[model samples]
Target: MKFSATKSTLVYALQIVQKAVSPRNPVPTLSGILFKTGADQLTVSATDLDLTIECTVPVTVHEPGNIVLPARYITELARRLPDVPILIETLTAGSAATISYGQSQSNIHGFPADQYPELPELPEAPALLISQGKLKEVIRQVIFAASTDETRPVFTGALLEIRDGALTLVATDTHRLAWCRLPVQADEIISIIVPGKTFTEMLKITGNSEEEDVTVYVSQSHVFFVTSVMQISSRVIAGKFPPYQQVIPREFSTRIKAVTRELLEATERASLLITEGMPVVHFNLEKDACVLSVHTEAGWIREEMDLQVEGEPLQISFNSRYLCDALRAINSNEVLINMTGPLSAAVIRCPENTQYLSLLLPAQPKPARSE
Candidate 1:
């Protein structure tokens, strides 16, 4: 295989696909990137059995062929290369390639192209086109809540539901739940569980372009995300996700509306007082303000923030980290907290947007204190 591409273009493609290369891959070829040269472009692909990433860059091809090179070696080399065109040529009989730019050149040994596993074929079903910005935003808001524990497979993935011409993504670690919905144009209802790690990698390649549309294709076992420059295919997690609809509370006895930033800041400060065995932050909801307090053997902190309260007064305790996670995911200026009582789970939502909701389970009861 032989191709000439600009250092910047080749480096970008290599970096994107390298995310799919597993560091501890047992299969030798799985740690390498497959490079295929065409008449006008070079395709770079990497896979780790479950996820695959492929990207193409414009290049001048002297010969149309393919080879698999070490992902780390090639990516690092290209990144450090001078800003000039890079020429890559592979021997016809051996898995050796020479990469040269300017006066620098290096010969690297690689695995044969046939040794690499083939990427999953794209599904023939009609694709769902959605804004890249919206998809990335929804993933960012919910992926953080997915359980990192691999034992419970369902909680380790995010539930993707498409119904009524809308899409919703829900994720939870059994302690806190994040849900985000977006309206889209689609015909059929679809539901699947996607590994959170896949979405985390997708965020890196989607970039910050909001105008671009991402085409989504789902097969029987794999899901594909296609954009102008790159494509990602991941195996769907197999299991039934928890019925998240029943998890969200429908009614509340007390509602507090407060500035999102202020509440987040107060919780962050209060969390500093938390210790190893204790992580609860107390919330005292009054008619005109909400007070967040944390008391531990080390110290005690109380912060009062103004808020608009309705329904009734209430008090509750929650994990400070859970509160911070939900608050950081919210982008609105004002957040609405709906509580049925001091013991029930609290529902947090944006006052201006009804499509997003976060449910946080209350912590263990704190000792009673004088008012």
Candidate 2:
């Protein structure tokens, strides 16, 4: 196959699709990117069985064919190519490709396109529709709470729940939880768990074009996110997400309403004193204010922030990093924190009419009676 494309266009597609390249897979072709010739475009694809990324760019095709070139070599080569049209041709004698640019040329051996795994196909109709801006926001607000522990695979992903026209994204690491809700046009209820890394990669590739609505196609085992020129597919995590309703406290004995930014900043400062491990921060919730203090080997930090506190005063300890994550993820100006006791979970919600909340479990928590 032979094709010519400008350096910028070719490099963009290569870099985007190469994100899914398998680093040390047993299948040699999986470590390479597939290059296929279209009528006037070149399609580049990479996959590691669980995740896949593909992109297409305009290219003048001389002969229609396909080849799988080493992702590392091809991407690096394209990055250094000068500002000129690159011509690539594959020889039939062996699975090898010759890339010519400017006055120089490079030959790199590759694998037959047929050896690459077949790309998964999705249903023609989309299961749900959500705006790019909304999806991006949901991912940002919930992905951080997903656990990185591989042993507990279910906690390493975010739960996507759609019920009665409402979409909820919830993630937890058994310590803290993040939940975001959005409205859709669906009547049936469906739930799926998607890996945290998938969300991270999607956020990285999607541009800031909030105007476009992303079409979502969900099968029994996979999901497809399709846009005008891009498609992202990933295997759904196979397991059950914990019932979030059971974990959130329905009623609280203490309610602390404070500025989200101020609280987040103070929590971050207290976290600075913790050199390692999930250190605990003390919260002294009072009638009209809350005091945050941390005592560690490095130093001690004390901060008091004014807020509208109600009910009984309470003292609780929570992981500093977890607390900061929940506060920073909040998009509202003020947050209303509901607490039951020193041992129960503390729920953080916006004071405004928003359907978002985070639940943080206290550190070194004791039973209510034991406390």
Model 1 misplacement above 4 A: 206-208, 368-371
Q: What ranges in model 2 sit over 4 Å off?
A: 365-371
Model 2 lDDT tens row, 47-91: 888888888778999999999999999999999999988999999
lDDT, model 1, position 294: 82
Q: In order, what lDDT does every prediction score?
A: 0.88, 0.88
Residue-level lDDT tens digits of model 1 in 294-366: 8777778989887888888888899888898899888889899899988899999988788999999899877
Against the hidden reference, what TM-scores do the models get? 0.96, 0.94
Best by lDDT: 1
Deviation of model 1 at 352, angstroms: 2.2
Give the Å error, residue 67, model 2.
0.9
**What shift in Å separates residue 169 of candidate 2 from its native position after superposition?**
1.3
Worst 10 residues of 1 by lDDT: 202-211
Q: Which ten contiguous residues of candidate 2 have the minimum total lDDT?
A: 362-371
Candidate 1 structure, TM-score to reference: 0.96
